[model samples]
Target: MPYKPIESYGVIGDMHSVALVGMDGSIDWCCLPHFDSPSIFAAILDDEKGGHFQIVATHEASFKQMYLPDTNVLLTRFLGAEGVGEVCDFMPIHRDKHGNRNGIHQIVRIVRAVRGSIHFRLSCRPAMDFARREHEVVLLPEGAVFDSEGQDVILLSPVPLKEDGKGGVTAEFVVEAGSCVTFALRHADDWTARNDLLSMAIDGEEARSRTVQFWRDWLSKSKYEGRWREMVNRSALVLKLLTFEPTGAIVAAPTTSLPEEIGGVRNWDYRYVWIRDAAFTLYAFLRLGFTEEATQFMEWLRARVSEHDGPSGPLQLMYGIDGRHELPEIDLSHLDGYRGSHPVRVGNLARTQLQLDIYGELIDAVYIYDRHAKRISYDFWCDLRRMVYWVIDNWEREDEGVWEVRNGRRQFVYSKVQCWVALDRALRIADSRSFPIDRPRVIAARDKIYETIMALGYDKERQTFVQVFGENALDASNLIMPLMRFIAADDPRMLGTLDETLKQLVSDSLVYRYELEKGSGLGDGLTGKEGTFSICTFWLVEALARAGRHRQARFIFEKMLTYANHLGLYSEQIGHSGEALGNFPQAFTHLGLVSAAFYLNRVVGKE
Candidate 1:
């Protein structure tokens, strides 16, 4: 089989983990148990060694794929000259009467002939531990099981199957119109547990109905009834899918090591939860009236803060879905990387880096949640107060900014501005709740940050705030100044910064994080160039709209939407040639889309 383009896939998940299903009816990327679990089928990263489960049509067929309306149930239609068949794929959301998702981890596929008789071929190949560990296959009455050292995968189907002679299963079947077959891939700790669950025959139609209702009911809670409702709703759905329901910690993306530059070494694992991303996601959920999600995340954040060891600061930059702090980076030397982008990495090392800006984002999210969702508990406020004091004491220090630049830390202007945001929002929360916060000290610290950034972070000659102090280079992150209320959007300084960013960092409305020209002395501790950052581009749209450039913001926002994949999904970045370049279905990109749409709609009176 040939490799599919990164964008040629749609995602389905159970809010615990996700699977990337290709249009060709193949599940190329799926982390079995959790979002960060080792891949059982990873042909998306390495087509040759990585395993896959495919149910493609035997005859030559054209494919059309879509999600069932207002739901994540994916339907991929295989149209052949003689017959038309469709495969509906979804992870059943088993919820109780209270609308909480029970821990049901399984992928269900219903194959049916829509037209005449159609022949289909099914292949079930399991490569446990990223194909690094070998497994044994056991034939079962219902289907087959792939048994590994610590885990077992059961593939159950009504169709007959034969051993593929390569420790896998293959089946061929024909179905006439009105006939259908259901297939399920389930993970278990042991065979007995798997058989116990499989004993209860899963009704395909009932499961489909339940899944559809779950999504529709959840989406009904959305408060957004504005222009671009479909796009905004879809982005919200993607964000919800990326969330790890058990902990309320959302992964940046499901799959990791998808290169930002094709065959380039810029890839890093994004499966961990970055505090900045979680905060932004919480803000988005709050905006859409999903207060439940915000509350869950706030609880998670409080727990993480409580676990902090004082001197090391409030929280790590990122953490595992279960809130584990130690995520050591490792390279998978055995399997070839995506397009041979060398040294496939797992477990981001940036967790240990000092990213001071996360404090601002986290505090800002708490402020939004406190105002819109619910009141913060007094105990949680005490923990947050410690973090706020930490920020006040360390606001002058330089650390990694929002971009998490690997190069040595400098006095990043955005970081200082965010420190200001932290104190400013902290003051608001204190005032609103009548909490006895240190008013004078926090106010002085906040004002000092603003003054320092204006004096040292700005380049008077270039008429723009540079990426760091004493550097003339521009960065798209500085555009957040107005969005954060650090400066008025139309203020002469901010306008100059915006104009300089538009001239240097933007290419045809797509925004780059920074200028990456060689010998420019601004490399981010990595070789090769990268794509236009999707989140930064959307940030530009919001910045422009805030600056009263509504028409221009709408134009750029509409253009950026066109860059989303056929299924309205976006990755971390978009290449110069307009291809999605990093992890697929990135939460940050979709969050940016929702934020941009919210602001643009309001400015254009579509709210």
Candidate 2:
């Protein structure tokens, strides 16, 4: 009916794609066949024109949603005054011994009555090619086939179904306390015969058990036994779900064009992988003993490092989930945005930006993963070495920083700090493993970079680092100096920077990304105002913890935890009214959560 809050949806995926099932029992958003495929249901972006598949009680009821413990299987319950109904939603996880996805996907929903009599309505709407292509509906004896040209979406069930006047299928039935109903929404393939699809609905119970076991087995490999285990485990699950298993490249988030500022023009697609986000996710996985993902992305990274050669460097800021380089931006002006946020968009244009900070994030990940999981071959080492040389040649260049601002490039201090990190970690790896490197040149360059930053980057009068080496506006990114090991946490200069960040960029215990105040015309390219940055808040917490302000760090950490949705999921930012303002279940926010939690737990326990 109306729009659901971004945080009101729970995610279930087969590691190839995910569907956002709302608390009201509607699959409001999903991309079938692949993570980047056209949506079959997109009501999250457009309420009326965008199609949806929903299973709900006909009677009014209060709803509650949760994940099955330690798994991504979601359960949504409708509790009415007279009866209660439950829907168990999951995508069957089918992976072979070698971990291949086998190129087929399905969303199997098993519904049951948990209490007295319940009346349920089930509707499966197909909006092919983002609701642009029309589909021909062929009704089966107990199911229906929606064919948008030759591509078919087969929906099968035990109950009888009929086509509504609109281009969709609908069914209504009543179930007693012990009865059950099943629905399977599948991506049609030549191999999946219609009878086999029917049998899938018949055996939904076995499939549910297998899916649950798959998640549990994957989660069993985690090595974290620290405080806040529930929230930490949920973050781990979010990371796992966001990962596109076929390529091992995790998408930043599933749904796209959900605005950073509602009704503002800040919306951009996040259903693609960014080098910085994946690198942080790798660190989170390695911290919890998930070495397989670490190993998989290393193979994925091998392809990315050699794919492109732009003017600035070899790598772009982000890539498609399947590792495609060309992501041409386009606007989908047909569908209204979520809550009428205008001009819904599909592909991201930011991928073309020259964000030099990615080198430090990616190289740092490889360095850590090599030490923990497996040894890097000389070929992989060479790729990393190429990245280091490029950074050395280009560290003095001004370009887009980690935030990917739209204004013209400036000498962002954070970008320079990461350039230093790239060289520092590369030197450490070379020395540790006897890898051949230009040791003299590397050392000279690293030292010079350090000297230059301390001189130009730091403001002597204010005793703090500036946003762009010349401007005076405080940035939460500069707090990353200690986290990146560029400066000692308690260094005199860093102490002043930390204090200034708190004073300028923080409100109500949450951290803003940067100042909108005009120091160097920072807000020139930005759209309307934005909310507090979710990841930056965690960065502040980690920075404070490292600086030995343990009490304030813990207070801020606990307060930020309260902002997560009921299912322990976080969007990219929090609005002024505390609503989720950006894409839901953001990878960057969860990675920051794990990083801060891992460091905070260890440091706090020692005290």
Candidate 3:
């Protein structure tokens, strides 16, 4: 079988859920209600038996897909020798007065004939519970229905759909110029309720038009009328698509287990929100005039920080949509993994680890919130102050680093710098509001941490920062030193670190998190190679721009943007072959794109 590279997928979503549409016009991964939910269509893992929703031209054709100008509406065109046809895919937003988000998600694929004629093939094979249960199939005049184990997939198609066996349905029909074909699948607990196809069609179309307007209106408010506007806007749209509108929870990525390495065991589930990326996301959202998202995230952060009682232990690394804590890791041994990367796993096991840097992330987010949102309750300030005190007491302790390495714990330089950041931001907040903190102690901790990291993490021989004390390997996490203002952007040490990282960690101008050979050190106890870290690359671009290497920064930035699929979407890592790996349409990656684009746009001229 022919395998399209993983980067061939395009993403479509309403705030509540998302689907990955491939170049072959198949939705191989989709989770209903939320990004973390069980998949309704998961053929991306098991190509043959796992379910998928596909709409393709019956005739042999070459395919191309792009989003409508400045909108999330995807237009996929199939061009064959005899004719041409297009499939316009979008998930219409349910909105209300004042633009408050509503909870309904609708995927509309409007098939239009652009030339003489084209035959269309429509099939929806939905495998629930990972294709384990047998489904009761029913055929209707309007379409086919499959009821399996309390989950129902009702297909509304204009053409007659026949059961192709094994809980699948297929339809082949012809359309001429000016003709249209529409299909929709609605998920409900009950399969007996009659579906109104005419209303669904009308509602779907209306939703599409409204969604386009919503996106266009959102982009219109962007202050980013600079160089690379198209790329920046596309990245912004993808970020918006990944955001869960109702709760203001932004997922790390839409689809999970895309794998970081091919046939290598570096796969991870990235459907949950990470504190590691929260502060940066706040900055990106605020930069784009997206206050609602920032506000929602800040609220979520407050809840997370407040829930864990005292600060002696590690902060929660990530959480479920409503902030549930228990993420029991599991491996699905039944299905062969994506592209023969075996042992498909779900529920990240890293949630329970002690990553010290999250304290810095939490503090930074709160500081920004204080600046943007009004002064919150004094109780909130007190809670923040206590958290800072906890960091000061515990920063010296060894814990899992930012990468959440699975081997063993070491005093990671990045973790130390962020601990300093926690104290620094807390000091700023306390001083700004005149809240009393042990001024000397906070300053002492800050300076001591800074000096300690510089003394230990820096390698005089290499003239660049190392991953840990007494280690020679370079880490992309050090790229944030200049971006975070921990060091002067042009400091000789910073320059050397950047150069060293470029030479070691970067691949074709993209960045990886760190050398896998070093071992992550947290000990979930697995070993394998993964994709180049997406956020690390953006950090490199930002550090480069800050260092006054605008030309190199701009080139790398533009080149990195090309890694995005046609819809301007990115995964967690770029594989060795440039295929998107390790989760589809990662939020952290999209946020990095937005942030780097803003900086690059400011420095470079309109291109």
Taking every candidate in turn, the Cα RMSD to the unseen true structure, in Å, is 1.5, 1.7, 2.6
* Model 2 ranges with Cα > 4 A deviation: 95-102, 189-202, 605-607
Top candidate, metric TM-score: 1
Better of 1 and 2 by lDDT: 1
Per-residue lDDT tens digits for candidate 2, residues 68-133, read: 999999999999986999999999986679966545588889899999999999988878877888
Residue 105 lDDT (model 1): 83
Residues 1-607 of candidate 3: C-alpha lDDT, one tens digit per residue: 2345678887788878888888778888887757887778888888876789889998999999888888888888899986899888887776688766654444678888999788888888888866676787788766777777666667777888888876788888899987877777766555344354323444556766888898898888776777778877887887777677767777777776677777767777778888876667777777887777788877777777677653326357888877888778888778777888776878888888778898887787777777876565677777777778888888888877887777777888999999998999888888888887888989999999999998999999989998877677778989988777799889999999998888878889988887766533432246666778888999999899888898899999889988887667787888777778877777788888888888887777433
Candidate 1 per-residue lDDT, tens place, 82-165, comes to: 799999999999878896765658899999999999999999898898888899888878888898988788888898788998
The TM-score ranking, best first, is 1, 2, 3
- Model 2 steric clash total: 0
Clashing pairs in 1: none
Residue 404 of model 3: what lDDT? 79
State every prediction's TM-score relative to the real structure.
Answer: 0.98, 0.97, 0.94
Ranking by lDDT: 1, 2, 3
Better of 1 and 2 by TM-score: 1
How many angstroms is residue 126 displaced in model 1 relative to the true structure, after the best TM-score fit? 1.0
Clashing residue pairs, candidate 2? none
- How displaced is residue 519 in candidate 2, in Å? 0.9
Candidate 3 wrong stretches, greater than 4 Å:
96-102, 191-203, 310-314, 518-526, 605-607
